[model samples]
Target: MSLFSGSLQKYGQIDILVSNAAANLSIDPIVSMSEKALDKLWEINVKASIQIVQAAAPFLSDGSSVIFVTSVAAFNPGTGFLNMYAVMKTALLGLTKALAAELAPKTRVNGIAPGFVPTRFSAFLAESAEILAEIESKILLKRLGTTDDMAAAAAFLASDDASYITGETLVIAGGAQSRL
Candidate 1:
């Protein structure tokens, strides 16, 4: 069975949907990147979220919440290697706002832009002591973000506590200068 059907079968209704799928298929600069790599990045990081939302829209009801997981790279892509990934993530920010307007008054749509966390997806950032220290030094908290930090933000957005909030992206980057 499909995910939506199985979810509805077991839960009766969909209340909260968090679309967090993303992939960084290439590290090459945009000019040098292959079309195939660019397409894959667009497919996984941006298109997938839209497709999932389209599938889940029918089951969503009033007071339901939809959260998209974007990244700090959306605001300030620090390196050229992340240009394409950043572009896709930036698209998600626009998608969050557009979807919020599209699904207003009933289903709320928001997003979370997480900072550098030492997950397998971002292990390269912490691969060396010099690099890790340099990154931490830039953060106001002087430490890398944790999964728990991201989880807390997501939980708040998904819960009734954030009922009045919509179409906003909370940046949980420990003050890593995501924006000017």
Candidate 2:
């Protein structure tokens, strides 16, 4: 009901709605990630997205934007570590496009698929500083991502400058396996 409250409080005047919340239980092979794992991921990453969009739809004005935060793991089947996490992210990409089409010209919708940003979500990968440094070594930039990197992209997409773009995904993988 945060969605409903945000709408009610905003008084049907939302300029932008960004769904940035996510959750991940464990990172193992798909065969090992079980029903509970799948259910938890679906609840947070998928259902909540639709629920919040439904809540925010009434508040959004024409030309408003909706940005869904996803991950490069969607296309890049991350490590064996991603498991169900990667699948949910991939589903998010589809959801972004589907929602964009559903919203149409009134509201522009897009997604950002960022690489490994250093955050609590990825703390699982770096249980310790040693591991964190180890993971950083693999990135094309020779460093992991920062929250600021993602913030800038989202800010730009939601801004009036991106008025013509919709149903697209901007990847922020630090030159990690990108096509020219």
Candidate 3:
């Protein structure tokens, strides 16, 4: 069975939806990036979230929450290598606001922009001691973020505690110059 059907069968109703799928298919600059890589990035990073929301919209309960796992790169691309990934994440920022407006008064939509975390997805950032140290030095906390840190923010957004919150992307980047 599909995930939607399986979820409905198990839970009866969908209260919280978190669209966290992402991909960085290429590290090449935008000008040099291949069409296939761009397509893959768009498919996994942006379109997948929209598809999930579309499929789950019918089953989402009243006062339900929808959270998107955006990236700090949305606001600050940092370097050329990450430009395309940042562009896709920037699209998600817009998607979050638009979806929040579209689903308001019943379903809330928000997002979290995480900093450099040592996950397998971000292991490249920590591969070299010099690079890791440089990154950590830039953070006000002087440390990389943890999965627990991200989970806490997500849990808060998903819970009733954040009832008044919507259409906002929280930056959990340890004061890493995310915004102006």
TM-score of each: 0.95, 0.88, 0.96
> TM-score of the candidate numbered 1?
0.95
The alpha-carbon deviation from the true structure for residue 30 of candidate 1, after best TM-score superposition, in angstroms, is 0.7
Rank order (by TM-score, best first):
3, 1, 2
* Predictions in order: lDDT: 0.90, 0.82, 0.92
The superposed Cα distance between candidate 3 and the true structure at residue 60, in angstroms, equals 0.5
Q: Candidate 1's residue-wise lDDT over 1-180, tens digit each?
A: 455998688877789899989899788988899999999999999999999999999889789999999999898764657899998999999999999999998999999999889998988767889878887888999889999999999999999999999999999999987862
lDDT of 2 by residue, 84-157 (tens): 77778888888989988999999999989888787877876767887777656767788777889999999999
Worst 10 residues of 3 by lDDT: 1-10
Where does model 1 exceed 4 Å of error? none
TM-score of 3: 0.96
Model 3: per-residue Cα lDDT at residue 62:
96
